[model samples]
Structures are given as C-alpha cells and as structure tokens.
Target: MRHIERQIVQLKEKILRVGTLVEEAISKSITALINRDSALAQRVMASDEEIDRMEVEVEEECLKILALYQPVAADLRLVVAALKINNDLERIGDLAKNIAKRVAQLAGEGPIDLPAEIRTMATLAQEMVRQSLDAVVNGDTALARQVREEDDAVDDARQRVRRMVLQGIKVEPERVECLLRVNSVSKHIERIADMATNIAEDVIYMVEGDIVRHRSSDY
Candidate 1:
C-alpha cells in the first residue's frame, strides 16, 4: 500500500479503538445502573481516561496524515470523518461516565422501581452506537442511514422515561431524588444516541461526499 493509504488505514484502526472503548464503557455503565453495581460503575468511570487518551491519539494521527499527505477526495473525507467521529466517541465516553456517576448516587438510595422504558432506550442507544461504528468500518452508507433513522426511537423512549419519572415523583415524593437520578441517566443515554447519530452522519459524509447534517431524513 502507498504510505498515505497506509496512514489512512491506521487512522481508521485508531478511531475504531476509541469506539470499542466507548462502547464497553456505555455497556458497563448501563449494567451498573440496572444492577446497582457501584464497583462496576467505578470501573466504567476509571476507563474514561483511556478513552480520552485514545481519542487524542486518533486526532493527532489524522492531523499528521493531513499535514504529510495533504489528502484530498475520499482520503480527505475519511480523515475528516475520523476527526469528527473521534470527538463524538469521546463525548459518548463522557456521557457514559456521567451515567456511572448517577448510578453511584442511586446505589445508596432507597429501593426504587426502575422504568422499562429506560432499558429499551438504553438498548436502542447502544445499538445505534454499534451500528454507526459498523458503518464506519464497512463504509456502508445504507447502514449509516439506518442509524440515522433509529435515533427517533431513542428520542421517543427518552421522553417516555422522563414522563414516567415525573409521574413517579408525584406519586412517591420520597423517591424523588432517586427518580431524578434515573431521569438523568436516561438523558445521558439519549445524548449518547445523538452522538451516535452524529457519527453515522459523518460516516455518510465520508462515503457519499454528502453533507447530511441539519437536513431532514429525505437526505
């Protein structure tokens, strides 16, 4: 392979590494929240540094490629996507960490009924993140578009969670603090879904040279 091509390949690998770390963090945070596993939540929080470091590494490599090769066309798009996706993945990692923090707070609270919608929302958000990364790996704009479409389901689920939490707060004022934490977790998961959608849009841009951001689904 040519030198620039090789660097681009490495760049993808590095970005995917960050994705893997962020995915694991998200999964662990959700598990910790549902199980009330403070130890596991701490583990997720601890790994944020690694994810942040990997993101920086990917960004540096992309800048290096851009400076050395001055890549244009598809190569430029790939590097640009890598840069944006790296930031998104890092933000996802931070959101997962925030969820872990909420889990830690709830771990000591009185027993509270967890909402089913929260689980559904978490599942959809995680799937979106996974599929978005897959789209990046395969350069599959179809998969990327599907990821974009799935964001709506997550948003709806998040709203349901918020309503359920609000009702719970009204019914059992004693559990208000815990329910608020649960709502915060749901919001974090929703933000993670948004970041995943951003990554998916970046993938579409990388592959089709189409800037689909801020556009309707018709794009």
Candidate 2:
C-alpha cells in the first residue's frame, strides 16, 4: 500500500480505539449509577484522561497526514472526517466523565429509583456509539443512517425521564436534589447519543461523499 493509504488506515484505527474507550466509559458510568458504585464511577472518571490523550494523538496524526501527504478528493475527505469524528468522540468522553461525577454525587443517596425510561435512553446511546464506530470501521453508510434514526428514540426517552423526575419531585420534595441529579444524567446521556449521531453523519460523508449534517431527518 501507498504511504498515504497506510496513514489513512492508521487514522481509522486510532478513531476506532478512541470510540472503544468512549463506549466503555459510557457503559461503566451507567453501571456505576445503577449500582451506586462510587468506586466504579471514580474508575470511569480516571479513564477520561486516557481518552483525552488518545484524542490529541489522533488529531496530531491527522494533521501530520494532511501536511505530509496533501491528499486530494476522497483522501482529503477521509482525513477531515477523521478529525471531526475525533472531536465528537472526545466530547462523548467528557460527557461520560460528567455522568461519572454525577454518579459519585448521588452515591449514598438512599437508593434512589432510576426511571425505566432513563435506562432505555442510556442503552440506546450506548448502541449508537457502537453502531457508529462499526460504520466507520466497515464503511457502512446504512449502519450509520440506522444510528442516526436511533437518536430520536433516545431523545424521546430523555423526555420521558424528565417527566418522571418532575413528577417524583412533586411527590417527594426532599428528593428534589436527587431527582435533579438524575435529570442531569439523562441529559448527559442524550447529549452523548447526539454526538454519536454526528459521528455517524461524518462517516456517511466520508464513505458516500454526501453531506448529511443538519439533515438528520433526511436519512
């Protein structure tokens, strides 16, 4: 293979590695929240630094490829898409860290009940990340589009979680703080799902040379 081709493959692998880390963080954060395991939450928070380091490394590799190869057309698009996807993956990592922090705050809060809708939202978000990364690795636009469609389900679940939290707050005023933390957790998960959708869109652009940003519904 040519040098530029080799660099592109390396870049793709780097993005996949970052995606794997983010996915694990999201899963662990949810597990921490559900199990009220502060130790697990701390572990997730600590992993964020590794994610940040990988993000920087992937970005530098992309820049180096661009500077040295000066690839045109499809090659250039792939590099640009990798850069954008790297940013999105890093943001997802941050969201996971935020969830871990919230989980720590809610620890020992007397086993607060998590709304089923929030659990569903978290599951969907995790799936999105997995599917988005699969799309990137396999160049599967169809899988990417499917991930985009799943984003709406996550949003709906988020709304349901919010409603449940508000109702809980009305019934048990003392649990207001706990419910607010739950609300924030749901919001963070929803944001993570949104970022996954963005990554899927970037994958589509890279593979098909189509612009799907701001056209989520058009998929």
Candidate 3:
C-alpha cells in the first residue's frame, strides 16, 4: 500500500474506535438512568472528555489526508464523510453525557416511576447509533436507509414520552420537577437518534454519492 493508503486505513480504524466508545457511552448512560446508578452516570460524564479528544483526532486525521493526498473520487468522498460523521458522533456523545447528567439529578429525587416510553426511546436511539456505525463500516446504503426509517420510530417514542410526562405532572403535581427531568432525557435521546440519522445519511453519501439529507421519505 502507498503512504496515503496507509493513512486512510489508519483513519478508518480511528473512526471505528471512536464509534465504539460512543456506542458504549450511550448504552451506559441509559443503564445509569434506568438503574439510577449515580456512579455510572458520573463515569459517563467523565468519559465525555475522551470522546471529545478522539473526535478532534479524527478531524485532524481527515484534514491531514486532504492536505497531503488531495484525494479525489471515492477517496475524497470518504474523507468528507468521515469528517461529517466524526462531528455527529461527538454530538451524540454530548447527548449521552447530557442524559447522564439528568440521571445523576434524578437519582437523588427519591423513588419515581420512570416512563416505559423513555425506555423505548432509549432502545430505538441506541439501535440507530449502532446501525449507523455499522452502515458506515460496511458501506451499506441499505442499512443506512433502514436507520433513517428507524428514526421515525424514535420520534414517535419521544412524542409518547411527552404525553406521558404531561399526564404524570398532572397526576403527581409534587413530582413536577422529576417529570420535567425525564422529559429532558427524552428530548436528548430524540436528538441522539437524529445524530445517528445524520451519520447514516453521510454513509449513503460516502457510498453512493447521493445527498439524501432532508429526504428521508424518499430514501
């Protein structure tokens, strides 16, 4: 392999490492929330720094490849897609961190009934993130499109959570603050699903050279 080819391989490995960290972060955050494990939540918050560092590393590698190789055709698309996907992954990490923060706060609020819809939202969002990364690694546009379709399910779950929260607040007026925190978590998970969709869209662009952003239905 040529020097640029070697660099590209290294770049792919780095991005996959970042993705693995992010997926674990998301999973741990949700587990923290469900179990009200404050220590786990704290760990998730602390690990955000590592995800941030890795994101910067990935972006720098992309720029180095672009500057040194000035690759065109598929190579150019791959580099550009990696840059976009890196940003999305970092933002997903931030969202997971935000979820962890909420979990920490909720842990101290005594016993409260967590909504089932929130769990559904969390599961869908996590699946989306995993599938999106898989789509990128395999250059699978079909899997990418499936991720896009799954985003709608997450959105629906978010809406269900919203409704449940409003009813919960009405029924247990004293727990208004706790319900609001749950609402915040639901919103964050919804945004995470959005980030996953964005990554999936970038995968399609990388593989098929198609700009499918804002055209999820057409996909």
RMSD of each: 0.8, 0.9, 1.0
Q: What C-alpha lDDT does candidate 2 achieve relative to the native structure?
A: 0.92
- Arrange candidates, best lDDT first: 2, 3, 1
Candidate 1 stretches greater than 4 Å from native: none
**Clash totals for all models, in order?**
0, 0, 0
lDDT of 1 by residue, 42-122 (tens): 999999999988888888898999999999999999999999999999999999999999887887886767898888988
Name the lDDT of candidate 3: 0.92
TM-score of each: 0.98, 0.98, 0.97
Which model, 1 or 3, shows the larger lDDT? 3
Q: What is the lDDT, from 0 to 100, of the residue 197 in candidate 2?
A: 94
Cα error of candidate 2 at position 152, Å: 0.8
**lDDT by residue for model 2 over 5-115, one digit each (tens)?**
999998998888999999999999999999988999999999999999999999999999999999999999999999999999999999999999998789867788888
